[model samples]
Target: MTIAFISDIHGNFEALKAVLAEIDRMRVAEIVCVGDVVGYYSQVNECCDELRRRGIPSVLGNHDWYLGYGGFCTRSRSVNECLVYQRKVITSENVNWLRAFHLQMQMDTVRIVHAGWSDPIDEYLTNPSEDYFARLSGTHFVSGHTHVQSIHRFGGKTYCNPGSVGQPRDGDPRAAFATFDGETFALHRVAYDMQKVFDRMEAAGFHDYYYGGLKTGAKNLRRLAD
Candidate 1:
């Protein structure tokens, strides 16, 4: 059975739709989300509704926690600003759904978390060492944060990050995801209509500062010149 993994949607419905279409075409048997269902984009409600409609199981991401529970992000002021805007537009039902997400999940042998195992909601697994993977108790682990797609193998164990569907930061301006076929994790990228996202963000009153890096897949969020 092939299981598709998606993460960090961040309210980009166009990207999410494109990814889902690809997953459907690939005939994946199951789909799971690593979270960040709402953030950094304008279609927060649409993204949430799609995921919930598909009954995708997802872990709690830091952004989701913030919007769902009224928390704040200290790492990025832009993130907090986006959260503030999202809160006003997101439905109460969607907020309730986001609040119900778990910190971690165990799907047979595959352990899933939104960020890292130690701090599921906020750790960016950018450069984990062999020791870090060794301490983990599972052969297959999945996480999504950092918006970078990656796979690390250590001591016969494997870790995979499906990357970000909404805001990719891996130097590849494409929607990113992964698939597990009970053995290896395969990374995939699909191009989507980014202009639609831009238009919607503009209509929603967000400036280019919120989405400029999406075209180049820059590691950091775009900011205005100093």
Candidate 2:
């Protein structure tokens, strides 16, 4: 089965729409989102609703937890401010849906998480050693959080990050995602109408940092390189 993996959408409906369009074109059998579906952007509800409508299986993200449990104040001040603004706009139903998501999921030979399987929502496997990857139980472990696209092979397992779909930090502005067909994995970078997402953020009165991140995927790449 061909599985399409995406993550770190951060509520950019335009980017998500573009990615979905591409996924539809590819005709993948399954689409899974790694998480962070409701942070840093203005269209949380729209994004969540579309994911629900499509019946995509998604893992919960840290941002989703912070938004649902009113834990924003304890997180990063900037992220707190963004969540506060997001809370004002997101619907109660969407919040509940985010709350219901699991931090990790396993299907056949594949394992999915917003971060690493070891810590799920909190730990990043960006620089995991061979021992670390070997410890993971799945043949294919997929995660996204550092927002850098990479495929790492260790021992007998494959670890992958599809990067960020809406707010890529990988220095490349193009939207990043990946596809796995059991034996092979392919990374993709697709261009979207960033100006449209920027305009929506402005119209919604979201903070500039959110929109600024979309202009370039530099932040994500920097984090990965670190």
Candidate 3:
């Protein structure tokens, strides 16, 4: 059985659709989300509805928590703007779904979480310390928070981050995901209607920087990730 992993789908329905199609083409048996099903874009409900409809299990993300309760982290002005708009437009049912996400899930020897295991909601474990790596018990540790696709191996543990499905920060702007079949791990990316997403974001009162950054695969976010 192959398990497909997706994460950081920040409400871009177009990208989600494309990624789902790609997953379908791969004939994956199980699908799981690492979270951030909302924030920084339009179609928050649409994305949430799709995931809920498909019965995909997802872990909690920081943005999902913010949407469920209130307030933003020390983020950008535009990010806060988008969150405010999302709060205004999101449905109660979708909010409930986002709020009900599990912090971490374990399947066999594989462990999945939105971010790191220590501080699941807020931490970014791109460059984990030796002590942290020593604590990692699973053969495979899957997470997504940096919006950058990566696979790291250290201390007999393999960490796989499938990147951002909605807002990829890598040099490639396609929707990023990965699949693992207990042996081989495969990473895949699919193209979506980014212009349509940009237009919708603009219609919803977002500025061009969102589109520009997404278009260029978030060169600005590289600094933050590094």
Highest TM-score model number: 1
Pairs that collide in candidate 3 are none
RMSD of each: 2.0, 2.5, 2.0
> Could you say which candidate leads in lDDT?
1
- Per-residue CA lDDT of candidate 1, range 2-42, in tens? 89999999999999999999999999969999989888899
Error of 1 at 104 (Å): 0.3
Question: Model 2 over residues 78-184: C-alpha lDDT tens digits?
Answer: 66666888999899999899889998888668888898877788787768678887665668888998888999878688888998888887688888899999887
**Ranking, TM-score, top scorer first:** 1, 3, 2
Off by over 4 Å in 3: 129-131, 221-226
- How does each model score on lDDT? 0.90, 0.82, 0.84
Candidate 1 whole-model C-alpha lDDT, 0 to 1: 0.90
Write candidate 3's Cα lDDT for 1-226 as tens digits: 8899999999989999999998998888699999898887899999999999999989999889889878686756667767889999999999888878889998666799888888888788767566776776767888898888988777677778998998888789999999888865678889888999989988987778666677868846523321
TM-score of model 1 relative to the true fold?
A: 0.97
Clashing pairs in 2: 169-217, 169-220, 169-221, 170-221, 171-217
TM per prediction:
0.97, 0.93, 0.94
lDDT of 1 at 174: 97
* Candidate 1 wrong stretches, greater than 4 Å: 223-226
